[model samples]
Target: MKKWLLNILQCIQDIYQILKEIKALYNQFTIVTAHLQTIIRLIENYNHLAEEREKTVDTDQHQREIKLLDIGQVMKILNISESTYYRWVENGELQPRKKGKRHYYYLFDLQDQIAKCKLKGRL
Candidate 1:
């Protein structure tokens, strides 16, 4: 009877030790899971930032491809004489991008000018 009781106590002690080890492993697993979640969030944020940079690059490329117009095309679009166009240029109301001896204008710039003129009731 004494031997049987000792064997039972040893079995209980072994189970207790196993339970303690399992609890420690569970705590470590929780910490590892938290770290993994943080890493995933960082990766998602990096991907979002990369997507934004790509969009900015695409917009810059599009702007580079924007059409440039000459003086005659600008005069025809604005329906103004060459003298009036030159006067507006001298007045700083029209700014043209100059390359060597040629002056070029962006369509977007002309559209903005038209919008400003409309706002002032001049168009």
Candidate 2:
């Protein structure tokens, strides 16, 4: 009877250890899921911005002259966030013309970027 009780206790300890490991794995999975959700949101935002940009480009393509646009105007025209624009500029994917405290982007370059991103399946 004493030996049987000891064996049951040992089994219980093993089960407890297994449960702890499962809990740890579950926590890691939760963290990964959150990161995946964030990435998905970012992708959706980019696709929406690309769609908006395509519409604007289609309308503006007929014009021979490209316009220099400020941050606010570019954001509105591209339907992208200020942070994304800044990040793109920092990554050298986009360029800005700085004049004192003001920055401007050329519409033609933005359109070209949109086309490249689309070709890369980024949009």
Would you list the C-alpha lDDT of every candidate in the order shown?
0.87, 0.83
What residue runs in model 2 are displaced by over 4 Å at the alpha carbon? 62-123
- The best candidate in terms of TM-score: 1
**Cα lDDT of model 1 overall?**
0.87
Task: Summarize candidate 2's per-residue lDDT along 1-123 as a digit string, tens digits.
Answer: 799999999999999999999999999999999999999999999999999999887867744266678889877766668898889889997788889978887777577677766677655
lDDT, residue 119, model 1: 78
Residue-level lDDT of model 1, residues 44-70, one tens digit each, is 999999999999788767765888899
Over 4 Å off in model 1, which ranges?
Answer: 68-123
Q: Which residue pairs of candidate 2 clash?
A: none
Q: Count the backbone clashes (under 3 Å) in each candidate.
A: 0, 0
lDDT value, residue 19 of candidate 1:
100
